[model samples]
Target: MTIMCSAESPNQPEIIIAVLAILLTLVFFLIYKRGKSTRRSILLTGICDSGKTLIFSQLVHKKYVQTYTSIKDNVGGFLIDNVFLKVVDIPGHERLRYKFFDEHKSAARGIVFVVDSLTFQQDLKDVAEYLYNILSDDVLAKNKTKFLILCNKQDQTLAKGSNAIKSILEKELNTLRVTKSRQVESVDPKTSKTSVLGEHGRDFSFQNFSLNIEFAESFGNHNKDGTNDIDQLVKWLLKIA
Candidate 1:
């Protein structure tokens, strides 16, 4: 009679360990792909004629440059204290702004929102609307981006200071909360599903954003005042970089 022999089944612990190893390898591969997929940025954004291009030139090109209006985004970078920081100067046209912002926001590390302080009073509503759009995006909040609300043209006599701009923006944003709440849909891709800006039963404040916001006054031109100059912006860049 021939002897009948059967091999034992695999060890349950060994099977589990082998499966876990494969899963861990997959997880690491995905993480590496995600890290390599996106480009990081410090974005320059605001309404047209808000000096974004000028400021961008100074920071990235180390000179003052201006165009009547930005037609497209300007992408560049500069070394900050030996660290290279990438920047994107988005065209602030109402029609064009959203597209550029959405494209780069996934990699945004900081946002520099330029404002025309000399014309702030006249541009309040437009400024408020555009700013509201930026602040409402769930992605920026999730990234915890640093925001520099740079009130440009601070050298002008009529320019609003940082504090005034902050106060005015708060009031306008509070009112905007009511207005935006009524909109059922937004045409923009990323901002279409924006998170609610502030807590209910409370007036809107910049603090409503988890973002680190700094309202600072500066002039993009070469005339550097002690604090009312690009120094503040450079300082801000250094910290974020």
Candidate 2:
């Protein structure tokens, strides 16, 4: 018996533990990668009649859509420059905007805030308020969310250009900051959710944000050349997608 017995394998338990560890690591890594890939969603938002729906239609169908007031959200998936994206067009009605933001903020990679270039001046205060709410959101700011102020309907003769839109928005936001600061001060800080915009005692500018904020022009309608002038917007989508 002493001559025939063989020693047991000394590394069996160690080998089994090593194998299990590798498998668990691989599984966690795959789950993380899948979650990251699935978060490639962009949100289209702004005031009503700002051309968000038209732009959404143009992006998905490559043609202008005659839309009525949207009562619900529009969502779709499309390929741009070989990258797939999930885009959501949230109804811009003041009552519904915050609801949409709350629902989509967790997964949104960026926001395209459409501005009705022709009517922006009239809606300047409302626009500034909506934008202030977004820029000052605690979660959005914490995440450093990207924003694109898309001045839409640029094909209209009186439509303001991006530079003018940017200048006007900055001025309006500065005024808004003062007003909002007073309101915030009246409320208890622990109960208030609004964050401060820009630095105290300094003028508000998009440059002051840690998030990437850009301005661009778009024409959801066909241009004089009969081509959709959404190339810049499409390019932005592709970059973020």
Candidate 3:
């Protein structure tokens, strides 16, 4: 008769712990990658004639072509910096923009608000309102979508630069935050707190957002020096991609 039992190794617990830690790390990494892969839509939105379609054409078709206001989203793809970008050129029309944006929002990785810098001064209010809607959206916030205020049509003589546009937008957004706060309070006092944007008592800055908000100059046409089109935009798309 024989009864034999081998004792466990001294480092058995440590080995188990290390193995578990490695597995946890790998799981997290895969989850992160999946998140990145699933979110690939880069939405282009703004008021009409802001060069959204032209930019879309330039990227997908490789030609800077003038386009009429599209009624539906002009979905396309382009490759840059070794990344394939899923660009969804949502119609800039007021009615269609929101509808299309809401449809593809689940896949949104980033957003490019194409502004006609020349008309930015006159359209400041509308521009600010549209941007406020996006910034305040629960879905956009939850998705942590990145934003780029594309100060497009910068090649024209009257067009403003990106720096000036950013300053103007910051100021406008600051005002909108106050306005929205009041509106929310009047409608529903309890929900007002959640509707507030930026710091409660401070001026709104793009920096206040946890998600990235960038501004870059671009155009969909040939410039004086013949190099002011979507080059900057392409760089931005690649960056967010």
lDDT of 2 by residue, 1-241 (tens): 3677788867988999999999999999998777657677789999999989888887776665678788888998779778777889998998899998789876777889999999999999899999988887777766566789999988899999999999999999989888777777778665323445887667888887667899999886644235457888887887777
TM-score of each: 0.77, 0.80, 0.88
Which segments of candidate 3 are over 4 A away from where they belong?
A: 1-21, 222-228
45-145 per-residue lDDT for model 3 (tens digits): 99898888888877888765657989999989888778777989998788888899899888988899999998999999889998888887888878788
The prediction achieving the highest TM-score against the true structure is 3
Arranged by TM-score with the best first, the candidates are 3, 2, 1
State the TM-score for model 3: 0.88
Candidate achieving the largest lDDT: 3
The lDDT per prediction is: 0.81, 0.83, 0.85
Model 3 clashing residue pairs (backbone)? none
Q: After superposition, how far is residue 202 of candidate 2 from its true place, in Å?
A: 1.3
Lowest lDDT 10-residue stretch of candidate 1? 184-193
Each candidate structure's count of clashing pairs: 0, 0, 0
Residues 15-134 of candidate 1 have per-residue lDDT tens digits of 999999999999999986564335358899998888888788777777655456888889998788887778899998989999999989878878889999999999999999999989
- Candidate 1 vs candidate 3: the TM-score winner is 3
